[model samples]
Target: MSVARKVVIEITSDNVCPWCYIGKKRLDKAIARAPSNLSFDVRFRPFQLDPTASPYGVPKLEAYERKFGADRVEKMIPHMKAVGEAEGIKFDYGGLIANTLDSHRLLAFAASQNKQLPVSAALFAAYFENQQNIGDRETLIEIAAKAGLDADAARAYIESDAGEREVREEVAGARQRGISGVPFFRIDGLYEISGAQDPAVFEEVFAKIAESA
Candidate 1:
């Protein structure tokens, strides 16, 4: 079949953020349900909601409560649970929240292997569902292994801060682009879609882009 056109969807998100997880799932659905002729080159960009988060990790609930207050935490949990469930994500919220620099670096390594998306998904699941610490080297290496990445190489990469500068610069760039929150989608260097929008919204935008192409 002849192609409508190709589109590059760049997603800026963090592993520890629940909304980013939901956004990723919804975007996956959108891409899967989009027009067949419009091939997609999905790029998972790096962003950290809290750049100062401890690499050693803090209890998820404690961090949320400290940052957002107990009342909001109470409300946020149910909202996340409901939204997460809709996206087929069973958010445990019992995991540790850690600095995602290493997680982002690991994703950069995965990009070279053409496994960025799966690795990103795995990182989210590791933090949000599996009660694992994404900031830890062994946990990241295990997640990397699960994503078919070379374990020794991945361990060496994450252990040494190989992509730290590049990832930090990329995160800075996202901020410089006026993005303060995550799950930001930049499509084809032309359109911008913010937040965890519905799959239908993505499909509509995709169709419009394809039509114009």
Candidate 2:
């Protein structure tokens, strides 16, 4: 019997993106249904939804009102809530809106320790569920610790310039590739799947790729 082919999937996403969170959940479900004759290596890449957002952050409603206007944001709330519920995410967008660069940096640090996914999930929950300020160093350190990373090391890593350059370059590279959105998936560095597609969509794509391999 032929050995299962190894597939690498790199996900470019931002913690601030609601669709990214949903996409991650859907991807997890799809992977669970993948054929037995396949192996997977999944990595999370960085993307900044708002690079210039203040480090101190702003009230969620205020930020939303300023950027997308009150009426549009208001209309989006129910839809966002509905989608999040379907994905088993109880999104509470009552937190502050801050720069996610630091969060991205923490994720890079987590990647080094092979704790990226947990850290990423924590950040998402902290921001969307617990409504915490993820841009704060202390908050990030705490989240990192909860994800099995050393608190002191995570703090030092976020405080220093360790992962800043790499994160910036990755975001820039995404832009260069004409990727203007989050939750973008690249399979085997060849096939591209954009947005928060359905699990069946991901499963079908995985099947086709595995067959071709």
Highest lDDT: give the candidate number.
2
Q: Give the clash count for model 1.
A: 0
Query: Residue-wise lDDT of candidate 2 within 97-131, one digit each (tens)?
Result: 79999999998888889999899999989999899
> Which ranges in model 2 have alpha carbons more than 4 Å from their true place?
1-3
Model 1 clashing residue pairs (backbone): none
The superposed Cα distance between candidate 2 and the true structure at residue 167, in angstroms, equals 1.0
**What are the lDDT scores of the predictions, listed in order?**
0.90, 0.91
Q: Name the top TM-score candidate.
A: 1
**Candidate 1 global CA lDDT score:** 0.90
